[model samples]
Target: MTDSKLKVALVGCGQIADAHLGEIRRILCARAVAVCDQYLDLAKQAAARFGVPGVFTDLGKMLAEVRPDVLHVATPPHTHRPLALQALAAGVHVYVEKPFTVDVTEAEDVLAAAVAAKRLVCVGHDQLYDPAWQECRDLYQRGELGEVVHVDAVLGYDLAGPYGRVTASDPDHWVHRLPGKFFHNTIAHALYKITDFLRDEEPRIFATWFGALPGTDCPTELRVFLQGADVTANLLSSSAIEPSQRVTRVYGTRRVVEVDLDGRLLRQARAPTLRGPLVKLELPWRQKREAARSLRRNLWHFLRSRLHYFTGMHRLFTEFYQAIRTHGEPPIPYAEIRRLMAMMDQIFRSCRANERLSALANEERRLNGQPVPISPLDPPLTTHHSPLTNP
Candidate 1:
């Protein structure tokens, strides 16, 4: 670690910026030097909150004046590409928010810019730092669960009544009008976790589909099938109910592991019994003993898990800092992010078309120089006229 703290510029003062700010405050090797946003007041607010000396409505001005070592882009989906490219071109490292960009083309552009500039670009897939998921990955790697046959992940929430009303009133709010669905918003976390366990093997989207509920603009249920290393996984998301829940279930021949949104893991497998079958069945001694053992195991795992989780968090920020220092690749490579964006495009198309869409199929068509088929049911792209542009 270097003795001098790195100067960092925060672009876009949004909800997510607060999380990054919290982490930056804890990191002794980095300090926020400036804040920027199109909305000058928002930028001022962030700068005041963080005690950053510089605030600007223009990123170029901030870059020129602050000469920050790193630029954290937490803007809306649409602004990510342009802002990140600018930062990279200015020879500054960039850390971007999730859904790297609204489209794969944009992601590729950003990646190409990074490559040309020899800068680092890291996406905020922070869930990878969660300890519970790390423990699950550890177990799988140790072969305690055998080969992962299949993975089922589901994330859902209720956003109809009050939430919908509020969002409707502020449709331009990035969260409300983000280019994609909850799958794109939440699945990245699950995808990152699973990819950590299955490294080097690129996951391909086999199918993507969605369904609707009675009263929601978003899909009621979203499903995606991914294949890798002869293993297939299904990711599902829904917004049809209250008391939101997230779960991941991985099945293997030897045992089944269940993980909740918070990364709690429960493993079930058959073990040798000491007591007679009749006695064990009637008294359930094995069950009792296993439960007690599980409690102790969970506590020990929890402590270790917390440390690992925070360590991963530090690693992520550290990588971002080093990327700024050395102009190298990030922990989560841009190629992976491009793949994610491509998969997300297929997901949105499938949801809109109400049919299974294949990302590989589209890529093949594009590679062959064939025109990709368009779905008639797909939502029309939103159109907006810029006030600064002449009619």
Candidate 2:
């Protein structure tokens, strides 16, 4: 829409804002013109950090004055809906953080607003843009990995960290207020990575929740099984565990590829021979060659420091910016966003229903004088939680 350079404005000054600032600075077609936040000092700090000349404590004021071509809604998930709607209403394209809204209805509303305003909205589902993830996608697309059989997307968290501690201690925190709570804020990272490979309109879910740290009300340990028509996906987010990593392992009919997102590594495993012990000898070499290639690529990124950390964000932002500048289709389509939100809403609702059903089954057994046993509907314990299916 812009023949000239795009003026990008960011509306959050938190940690993720730094990533947006970096990429906005790097993109030749766009520049950070202003930043806004409720905290004036945070806005000032980001403005100073990014050399953004305009800063505002109010988003409305910033929109009225600078009228940025694109706005990044990096605020908390709860604030995403209103802020995004506001940006669309003002005829500004929006890029919002993951879990684009707290729930499906809000996501739909934002999409509708974007349509009405003739603007675009891109979710910060940036992980799939990471180099390693992109390579994995390419492999699948080219049929080098064969048909995707299953997907396992895992994310680990450190509960002692600032975010965890803050949410754990504050009952009134925006995270706790979310319909899906902490999981809502994060499930997108795990789900969006592999959902495209799934063919089903609505995947059935089996979920499990437990607190790794006893006496804590927050369910730090969680897992979900997503059953697709052709490919199944396992989504894991465990704050109770350590060795924090973001990884997605894709199983294919002919081979399996492991996409280590945090490590920025990709490995392919395949039948190295038509027959016999030769494959035993050939497979390791094949894996080693792939790993080494990935290492070289990652090393190149590492030499750059800050860019290495925000590589995916940078790529995602660049593509979105280019599409806007060229009047091309949005980088991620609105229908995809709708499908993603629907999947998430179903996951949250189905899991809660599972919990309630489990409780009810227990009560039923006690009243009927039958021996109490674990309900089949109840999530079974494993590295995975139970499936949360819609009744």
Candidate 3:
């Protein structure tokens, strides 16, 4: 291992590239030596903003000249595999953003190339490493949550937000071209949170896709049900939900742990010991106390300049650099990466099947002079009085 600080380079100067640049600056052991993008102006702008020394329009040139120890691939999903393979071939470790590849096959190819090059690669499942999620993980690992009974992972998207607004308007946006469309690009942040409890490699998945927002043809809402060996999980990715959030609630025999990724808060709810009315009163007070504690903790972190929105990204980069220096395993295991990709493949397949069957059923109803069934997208998931509502 080199005694000098690790040199990092980033490719794809999009919105996520800014995140990588900002977080890399926070890691004392690493520095952004170079930035690259197809658009020379974007690369130059990022380098200037981040105080990066090297800027390039060509990735090969950057790899040859700057020779960074790590490369952050912040490009679109389809470009991840090739860019990563190129970096690995040049003896550079890779840190890719979520939806590591378009599909499982591409994921395997990149991982295999990394093994052949004797380098390491990590996917940017940042939400799983958030501080609140870390606390939830610790509780589950220490058996404080007991055996997991069920899990709910919710990722709310705001169509009116900066990125969403652009994607909704741009027909040629990269996200629209992906196989699963927006779901492929974003649902990973939600699904990865539940993978810890639903460890079955080949879980039964039932997924439905629908358009919740009035936008392009692509669906804006996704509902997925996964049944693993002993645990079952539900994942919701909705752009219609108000005040969008990224939350995961794990229900165990002994307790319930909810990690609010947006607010960076962790709360636990336990079965009431008191009988009848007292139990209801005590529960609300206990929840209030937990919320207050979370508020104070976040305030302390904020004072220390550690409560930034991308703190999870900063922590992940720090750990990955440490792993590279020590030749240790990455923060996320390769098996987990493959597992996630495989699950996505199955879920997307189910979504397609659902669409096909819906079309057939609707046609049959029309021929019989009956009213057409409502598509899943016709109404928001929130309006449905289903068991999926958080307990």
Per-candidate total of colliding backbone pairs: 0, 7, 0
Best by lDDT: 3
Ranking 2 against 3 by TM-score, winner: 3
lDDT of 2: 0.82
For candidate 2, which ten residues in a row score worst on lDDT? 377-386
Per-residue lDDT of candidate 3, residues 1-391 (tens digit): 6588999999999888888999898888889999999999999999989999999989999999999999999989999999999999999999999999999999999999989999999999887778899899899999999999899999899888888988888877888888899889898888888898889988888888887334567889899999988999999989989989888899999999999978888889998888889998999998999999999999999898778898788888888999999999999999999999999988888887767666666676688797875656442222223322211
Query: How does each model score on lDDT?
Result: 0.67, 0.82, 0.88
On the 0 to 100 scale, the lDDT of residue 166 in model 3 is: 86
Q: Supply candidate 3's per-residue lDDT for 386.
A: 33
lDDT-best of 1 and 2 = 2
Task: Report the Cα lDDT for candidate 3.
Answer: 0.88
Q: What residue runs in model 3 are displaced by over 4 Å at the alpha carbon? A: 212-215, 377-391
Give candidate 1's whole-model lDDT. Answer: 0.67
